[model samples]
Target chain A: MNNDILATLSITDATRKLATKEISSLDLVRACRANIERRNATLNAYLEVFDDVEAQAIAADTRRAMGEKQKLLGIPLAVKDNILIEGRRASSASKILEDYIAPYDATAIKKLKDAGAVFLGRTNMDEFAMGGSTENSAYGPTKNPHDESRVPGGSSGGSAAALASGMALGALGSDTGGSVREPASFCGVVGLKPTYGAISRSGLMAMGSSLDQIGPLTRTVADAKLLFEAMRGQDPLDSTSLDPSFYKEGLQRKKIGVPRHLLARGVDADVLKLFEETLKRLQEKGYALVDIELPSAGLALAIYYILMPAEASTNLARFDGVRYGLSRRGESLFDDYACTRGEGFGPEVRRRIMLGTYVLSAGYYDAYYGKATQARRTLSRECAAALKEVDVIMTPTTPSPAFLIGEKSDPLSMYLTDIFTVTANLTGNPALAVPMGEVKRTKINLPASIQLTAAHGGEATLFSIGREIEAV
Target chain B: MYYDAMVSKEEVRALAQLARLRVSDSEIEGLQKDISNILEYVGQVGSIVPNKGETQVLRAQNVMREDILYGPATGLINKGKELLTAFPKREGDYAVVRKIIHKDE
Candidate 1:
């Protein structure tokens, strides 16, 4: 097989070819490695290309030779640095844990391993998955494959970049407030954030416990569905992991909802045009598009910032430089922790930790965190109510196409990129970002995406609708 | 539509201390402005009227399993050494840390 052709084949196509013995797993891994060798230096996608990739592929070939049949068999996959793959470094792209090796496989990784997936390497990400762009990664940002100067949307930016650049066939990225979907949008790939608790989070680093979920970034909606199906299951390790029956799947009504008020402002003109075009295509495909109201969604980002920081601050307290990761010595134990954390975490991570402390602190908790919690419930209710009328809610994944590497300097502007995507995370609803079309920027057409958010346990609806959108 | 709430530099310092993070003097001003702006933006949640007698929604439930040595039974043991190997400061299967208790106190 032509290496270029093999590198670009989607997981579904590649699996079929593998089954027919038309292409060997070694051929796929080598093709991916060739692409990585050519582009990874400039792309900075995979933080480390595992030295054992060939061995893993050889094992997969042996498995197939033994007549084992698995859908993900012999697939090369890039995993975000936050997910543990057992004995591999899972630094979460932070200096504090730069050399920290995961002692156990994340539940999702275990499932993929069982399916015969070959581990390419851990991909780069925003340190602690805090930034909207991968710019906050301690190692450095992953660039967009479409445009070298532009950023791959993040904090799952590396995973998205790897897939878009053909460095990997599929990738696993953890989504906490658009980490997966936003990058998927910016990179012109399919990114899914399964409903909270739908996928187990056992081996994934915790960012915002309530909001974080591990999902797949793939070239096609069917590939995303296959990966999601393979990974979604209850795990004894994660208390929040839910069984398939935890929430009943919603009935498909062949309808899509649009909250026009939210999109009336902030969204880029070109992105809005593409989103309208996507909706029109869907409409022409025998689906009804209805204007739905999610009034409380205006507060979704605010609630997310408040809740995510608060939870992150609590979660990150574990990195005290004692048990594992980077350690530093100071005059006193307090100094040790202060200096260690102060120097260990990046600016973004420190800012978030302090913000979390401020919100959860006395005299301010009720004003910020408490109210945010109340407003979150309101937003969840609005989403649930809105879904009662429509099969899924749709919006532009990010306000614009991939922004230039350093475009969003101000923190607030950067946070606004997640305006539409954070609502899904806040409500624990499953959301997918599929490439709607591209918007021109500086002589190059950059990808922008339309996000479809479904009701709880409504992934099937998203897959069907997403596939239609992909077809269009 | 600007929110009046502003996080002061002193407050940022105090919060940083509480969070066990040390922010240099140079970074304090930036944190003050960024944190205040973020707080003001998120404070919009305060306008939401609470429902009558509504309780906080708690999705977590007690998930209990029988307390038994399941890892070894499932052939998942041998992780003890791996876990121990991660300790920054260790002494023969125990992580070493500074003593907090002083008898003289």
Candidate 2:
């Protein structure tokens, strides 16, 4: 295959070629680097392309030559800036840690490397994974590959864009709310937020540690399943990591749940039209579709905003200049500490920190943070109840497709992008965003993603149904 | 939810200080006005009547593990030390900072 074709092949396809000795890991890495050089300017997907990718590729080739039996042996992948790859800068695209390099590999990165996966480079994200649009990054917003002016939905914008533009066959993304799925939908790729604790978060930057999850954004559902299996399992480093039992069962049912009432509000007309047609198409494929009601689903975004920011505020307190990372000096010790944080963090981050701090503060904690957590319990219960009735929950990943970068100047409007995807996060349920189809006119092909959420450890069901729907 | 409930520029400055973010005086005024406006929208959550005391807060069930040495955390502390050393300012074995408390502890 030529360089573009090689770069575009999913991880499974690339690995099969490598295992058969048809194409070397070196060729794949070089092709990807070349594609990055040619396309990254327009896509702005990557903040830094590794100068040492060839070396890693050579290492993978050496391992394969020695008869290594790993499935991902010789596959190339991208790590989002938020994921640590020992001794590399894992900046989450912020000035706060611009010069800070990670000392250890994240559990997911370590597993992938052990499986002989070659590291491409770190992709960009909204600073601290704070915004719905990539525009919050201090480095500048990542443009959608489909349209230059529109944003590739964010926090994971660079990861989704890199995969779409062929910089890497697959990339890992961290989703606190809908960071991964929203961007995947906007870019027309597959993104999975495996059930909470499904993938280890030991080396991933803490952004709302309770809600954060690490998963893959790839071109196909099979590829997502491949990466998810490779990186998932129990990790001692992350106390919250789930056992392998969560992924044992696969989706075999012909029945699926479609939540029409939940998805009806705020959904753009074109987006809803495409979503309804997708359901019709699935119905025609011999699948039983049941319209279900998730009563607490509408409150997902509201609950997420309350709980995530509360966790984020406490988690980010460690970046105080007294420890490692960036800092600014002043005449007095207090002045130095204050100035460093004052300048280091961006506005949205500061806003969240303040809101989080206030909610968790002594007086109002009972009213805000306490109440949000209670609602989250109800949300999780609702998900469990819905899953008992069907194999998967289907909905549009985002209410709309990629919007213009500056279209949502108001912060609340920008936050609405996560409305559909947050319920999965709130419920700690595994969900996948599979591209359904496109809309008319606008250069944007409205990628309607049906969210397939299985009960905890229900990845098999998700993948089986995702494969079926995607095949259609 | 109008100017009557408006967060004043003075309060914004105090909030900025409390949060360790620097806001210019003019910026504080703008933020005070802007944040108050934004809160007015999000304030709808206040009207939501949550069930009485049934919701249990999600807490990390702390699990203590055996003191086992592993490869992943192996080089972590050393790397942290190295990065701390590289920071522009530091006192022996620590990243030096302006004392946070103005008064003696």
Candidate 3:
């Protein structure tokens, strides 16, 4: 098979060919490897490509020969470094856990293994999944495949980059705030952040436990649905994991809500144009476009920054130089902890930790963390109320397309890129980022995306509408 | 739209110590600025009028499982050795730590 054709094949197409004996798992693996060899050096997508990929592919082929078949059987997929795969180094692209190996597979990985998916390798990410761009990775950033001068959009940037560049047919990413969808938009791939608890998060590194979800990034909406189906289920290990029937399907209204006030300012011109075009296209598809109000939506990002860092600081306290990960000794026990953590975490991680510490501290808790919690409740209420009237809420995934690698040097500026996508995470709603079209950059045409957020457990609606937009 | 939230160097140092992070003197000024800027940005959360007396209900429920030795019957518990191997300092099967209390105490 031609390498280009093999590399570009969707999981659905590849599986069809595999079932018909037109191609073997080895052919798919080799094609992905060829692309990795050609582009990974410059893209830096995979932190480490598994040395046993061919061996794994051979096992899948053997299983197929034995008359067993699965949807992802023998399919090549990229995994984010944050998801554990038992015995493999599952660093969240942080130096603290750089050499640490996972003791067990994340539930999602176990599911994929059961479905016979071939693991390519772990991809790069922002350290501790803390930043908007993969630039915070302890290893160098994963550059955009469309333009090496720009970033691939982050925490899951590497997973999206790998799929966009044909290094993998599908990939897994964790979304806390816009980690998965933002990168998917920047990379011009389909990224889905399942409704919270829709997928078990056991074995995935915890950033913001309440907000975190493991999702799929794929070339097509159907492929994304396939991966989501394989991974979504309640698990005993994760108390938060919801059963498939936890959320009843809602009545289809065929109405899309747009909070035009939110987009009135701060969005780039071309990006807004693309967003308007997508809304018009949806309107033409017989979906009623209505103006809705999410009055508290403006505060979602602020609430996220406060709540996420607070949760992150608490979760990261386990890394105290005693149990696991990097350790350094000092004069006293306190010094030991200080030295170890200071040397172990990167700048962004430390900043967030300190910010979290400050927010959750005695005098400031009610002012920052406490107030954020109340606002969060109000925001969730607002979203629930608006969602009652509309089947889905639409917005541009990011203010602009892929920005220059170091363009957002200031942390606040970078945080703004996630402005439109964080509300779904805050509300525990399913959100999908679909490529709307491309916007021209200086020398390249970078991808822009439209994000559709559905009511909780409304992933079916998202997938259906996302397919329509994809087709358009 | 400037906010009154400004983090001082002393506050940053205090937070660094509380968070178990060591910051060099050179990095303190930068941290002071960065933390102040971040706090200012996130402080907008405080602008929302607090809804008092209405108890907020969280979506999570307490989940309980039968307490028993649970693992794959395939000797997955032996992975404890791998966990033990990750300890920075180990004596036999125990992780070593600095002694906190002196005999005189």
Candidate 4:
């Protein structure tokens, strides 16, 4: 089979071939590398394509010969810069940790290693996963694979781009806010952010401690389930990790709730048209679509921005000059810290840290952080109320298709893009982004996606619905 | 009660100091403007009346695990030397730090 065909094959297809000994892990790795060699330079998807990948594949082949048959045994995967894979450099796309090598594997990475999956390299991301675009990466921005001029929606932009461009069969990305799903929507792939605590976050760089989740960016919903299941489970290291029985799997209700009020103003007409068509398709298939109201839904982005940055500010305080990575000294201890952090973190990161500090400070805590937390509880309850009526809630993953690399110059406008996706993070509900169809922009058919959010512990529902959407 | 929706230059500097960051003069204006705009947008959360003194019950519970000295936390994941290797200024296994406490001259 052609290398292009081999590289482009989905995990489901690749695993079957690997199981039957029809394809070697070397073939899969080399096939992925061939495309990476061709496109990575321009796409800037991978920060580094590990030189030892071929050796890893050879070892996997040896294991297969011994009657070991793990589905991910030889599957090559792209890991986001934030996930630690022991001994490998995990930068979180920040200059401060650029030279820092991981001391231990993230729980997710360990699980994948147990499954015998091969790591391609750490893909680029927004520094500290702060921005919605990979442009915030200290190294550089990751362009959308579809159109070079547009950005792959970000934070997990590189992982999404890698999967879309056939650089990897599957990829892992961490989502806080819309990091995973937004990019997945932009790149026309499948991304899942499981219910909070569903996946252990040990060894993943801390961003918004409360909001951060390691997710899979893949070509198909089935591929995501395979990766998610492999990575999900309780970990003693990450106390928040949930047990398998924590979230019960319920029968598909075939009901999707649409919060029309939130979508009425901001969503692009063409994007809404595709969303409506997807709803109509599901309705024709005997799924019921009910209009639901989440009164606090509109405030989700506001609450998320407040809460995430507040958590990030504290999480980032550990990056003082003494411990690791880039450390700079100054006249006094205070000067040492201020100078090191000032020079270390990117502008967006600094901006967020400052925002977080302001919110958590004495006078403003009640007005900002305090109110946001209260509102977050309200939002969660509202989502729960809505979920009680319907199995899942639906929305356009992003307001529009992928935008030009530098299109959103203003920070507020860039944040407005996340309006539709932050609700799930706030509510602790599992959400999936699957490409619905394409919407044309400037003579290019950029992909638009539909986001389905299921109740807490409702990942199975999202996957089943996601597969149904994939069929559309 | 600062409701003007504008973070002043002095306020930005104070916040930067509190956060242990230094904002250059040129960047401060832009950063402050951006911060204020975000504050104004997110400030709407204040308007949400929380059920007239209803208690906010967070679903998060304390996750306690047995403190196994050689468990995954310390044994499986933690490698002392590998962690020390990341330190920029280390003396053997100890991370080197400046003397923050200075005796009166």
Q: Encode model 3's per-residue lDDT on A1-472: one tens digit a residue.
A: 8999998899999999999999999999999999999999999999999999999999999999999988899999999999999888988998888899888789899999999999999999999898878999999999999999999998899999999999999999999999999999999999999999999988889999999999999999999999999999988788888889876564388999999989999999999999998888878989899999998899999999999999999999999988799899999999999999999999999999999999899988878887788888889989999989999999999999998988988888888999998999989999999999999988689999999999999988998999999888
TM-score for model 3? 0.97
What are the lDDT scores of the predictions, listed in order? Answer: 0.91, 0.81, 0.91, 0.90
DockQ, all models? 0.60, 0.41, 0.58, 0.68
Q: Per-residue alpha-carbon lDDT of model 2 for A1-472, expressed as tens digits? A: 7998898898888888887899999988888889898989888899988888898889888988998868787777887899999878888888888888787889899889877788888998999999888889988889988887889998999999998888888999999898999899989999999999989999899988878999899999999999998999898888899877656566666788988887656888888887788778878988888988887777677677777878887788788776666777766765675678778888788777766766666765666666667777777777898888888888888888888889998777888788888888888898899998776436546455667778888888888888877887
Interface RMSD of each: 2.7, 3.3, 3.0, 2.1
TM-score for predicted model 1 compared with the true structure: 0.97
Off by over 4 Å in 4: B56-59, B70-78
Off by over 4 Å in 2: A444-446, B1-6, B47-53, B67-83, B86-88, B99-105
What's the interface RMS deviation of candidate 4? 2.1
Model 1 regions more than 4 Å off: A247-251, B1-4, B57-59, B72-76
What is the C-alpha RMSD, rounded to one decimal, of candidate 4? Answer: 1.3
Q: Write the per-residue lDDT of candidate 4 for residues A96-190, one digit (tens) a residue.
A: 99899988888888889999999999899999998887989999999999999999999999999999999999999998999999999999999
Give one digit per residue, the lDDT tens place, for model 1 in A1-472. Answer: 7989999899999999999999999999999999999999999999999999999999999999999998899999999999998889989999999889888888899899888899999999999999988999999889999999999999999999999998999999999999999999999999999999999988889999999999999999999999999999987777788887865554468889999999889889999999899899889989998999988899999899999999999999999988899888788889889989999999999989988888888888888888888888888889999999999999999998999999988898899999999999989999999999888999998998989999888898899888899999
**Candidates 3 and 4, the one with greater TM-score:** 4
